[model samples]
Target: MRFATYEHRDQHHVAVVDEDGTLRPLSGVHSLTGLLTEAGSVPELLDAATRMLDAQPGPHVSEVRLLPPLQPPTVRDFVTFEEHVEGVRRSVDGAAGVPERWYAAPTFYFTNPYAMHGPHDDIPMPPGSSVLDFELEVAAVVGRAGRDLTPRQARDHIVGYTVFNDWTARDLQSAEMRVGLGPCKGKDTATTLGPYLVTADELEKYRDKDGFLRLGLTASVNGEVVGEDLLSNMSWTFEEMVAYASRGTVVRPGDVLGSGTCGNGGCLAELWGVRGRQDPAPLKPGDTVTLSVEGIGSVSNTVVPGADPVPVPIARRRTRERP
Candidate 1:
């Protein structure tokens, strides 16, 4: 079953998305995270959502404001695509190939969960940034808590999938990473999730023999297709990424695991790597970016001008005496 969180008549609701794209509100449920935690399991949640759908559909998808499916407790983005790594290395790192350590295991980085945006929300240009960009990927929402889980065990913990756009500030990211500390301010601006959350069972038909989901992923900027790739191209599957994430830590319900950027042209930074810096220009105010995942859904966000940067003092070095 598909589920959505939307706003109508100034009220927020958690609803079951019907086959025709109409919404059927889950009685008394206003938060997707609350519902997920309350149900404790996907089967139970599905049962409850189904029971609530017996009522008349409330509104058509076009009539309401779509929201980020859930407010995740934590967000971990994994770089699972070898091609994306290869391209970025050549472009940003000025290297020819991927590092061997990348093949050792799935790797990820945490981003600001508080900065999430909904499917159709307006994303402002982050302060002091001129190179605004978008990343096309999918994300898995944890339904049950688990720790030290293996790949197989992790599979059952994921309840649903949603389209994720990991917005970036290219110049800021490049500068900060040179100091070996960040992608911090660069990525803290916005992370888009939604349109709708498709249940794991709903995507079963797309699974390949190797257990990878062979779903087509695409990204467009102002209606022009900028990047396209198959989700199956990732070197490591979501299960592996999730398993690696839980190695020594707990992954709780409502936590989100992003599939990072896809290959080919999953993000503008990757495009800059393949083409030149100015080929496909960085996003500016009034640009609309739409990212779509085959089985899940599409999230389209409009870029808007942000407030002027508030200046801060530059770091000053201090002299130290030998102890």
Candidate 2:
């Protein structure tokens, strides 16, 4: 079953999207958050959902305003693709290889969850960024909560997946890394999520012999295809990423964890490594970006001006002795 939070009648509602692309509200349920908090609720939620579907569809998907499927309690994006890691390292470390530590275990960073946008939303180019880019990736949503779980055990915790576009401000990211911190201003500006969230059961057919789902990745800007990849190329698995996240802390429902950039030219940074940064220009206002995965739906966003102009940098002056 596909799920989403959409706006109708000036209020947001949690809805189940049927196979026919019709949406019907889950009776008595206010948000996906509530259904996810406890076990055995999905079946009940489905029964209620089915009842609504049994009747005529309440709304066609196009009529309602779609919102991010869930308000994630936390968002951790992991760099698990060796190709992406190697590409980024070449630009920053002057080496094109994954760090030994990364092979030992998956590593990730926490990003702002509140600033995320939904499908078809307008994303502002960060005020300080002239090199805005998009990271094409996929994300797994935590269905159940646990800590210190093994890879096999962690697998059960994931309930579903979604296409994730980690919008970036490359200029700000490059500068902050020099000081050994951030991705703050670089990424927190916005993240594009949804079309809708697909449940794990719906994706069982896509799983390979090794239990990883095989899916194609595609992204285009202003109707031009920019990047492409497959989800199966990651060296690390979502179970591993989830287990690593739960090593010392609890993983909760609604916590979103991403697969980072795919091996294909998933972003301008990686593309620059392969093709150089000459022809495929950086994003600007009015440019539209659409990202999609095989089974999961596609999400598109248009670039727009920042909410406010970039804040000016503070000026400094030297003082003489002890004035």
Candidate 3:
């Protein structure tokens, strides 16, 4: 069953999408936090939610504002895709150099939750961004709290799936990484999630005979298709990412784990050269980017540069020897 957090009138509430395409309020059935605060219970809740949706009558789809399904306590994104890492590494090899360990370990970063937006909202391009790009990703909502979880135990902790667009500022990212610091300013601008959350059981039917999740992902800029990739190409599985993330730390319910950018999937480096004669067509003031992942829905937003002008800070590089 499909579920969503929606705003009707003036209040925000949870709803379940029914077979007849009607939305039924789940707020009366269960508390939003109670539905998402534990593991292995989402399936039962979804079943109950579906039954509740089948019984109630509600407004048409065009009248509701869809919000991000879960208010995750912590938003963690992982770089488990080798293709994206390699693409960035190759682009900066001549000037900035690449790290050896980056290819071996699964790396991740914590993003600011305050910057997240829903599916149909307008994404404001940061004050000094001339090279804005998009990352198409599939994110998992954690349902259980745990530490040091094994790969076998990781799958059980997932509640559902949602499409994510990790909007990025390429110029800022490059400059910031030169200091050996993580992607702070480069990636902190905005992250878009939503349309709806599909429960794990609803997605299970789409799993291929080969035991891999089969989902088609596509990205478009101003009605032009720019990148396309499959979810099956991921080098590190979601279970592995979850296992790694849970090591020595507590991962709570409603926490999100992003599957990084899909290979040659959605970023500018994957679509065009990172640095070359042909510069990527960075998003302009009026460009609209739409990301669609099969099973889950599509999210489209228009880009507008920030109104006020701000100075671009000069970056200081670290001279430490490479390991």
lDDT of 2 at 62: 90
* lDDT score, candidate 2: 0.82
Residue by residue across 120-209, what tens digits does model 1's lDDT show?
999999999998999999998888888999999999888889999999988888888999875889899899999888889999899999
Clashing pairs in 2: none
After superposing candidate 3 on the true structure, give the runs of residues whose Cα lies further than 4 Å from its correct spot.
29-34, 38-40, 47-55, 92-100, 208-211, 274-280, 307-323
lDDT of 3 at 36: 67
TM-score of 2: 0.91
Which candidate wins on TM-score?
1
Q: Is candidate 2 or candidate 3 better by lDDT?
A: 2
Task: Find the 10 residues in a row with the least total lDDT in model 3.
Answer: 89-98
Candidate 2 residue lDDT tens string, 187-239: 88898889888887778898888767899999899988988888989888888
Give the alpha carbon lDDT tens digit for every residue of 155-176 in model 3. Answer: 8887788998888877778777
Off by over 4 Å in 2: 40-56, 92-94, 309-323
Each model's TM-score?
0.97, 0.91, 0.87
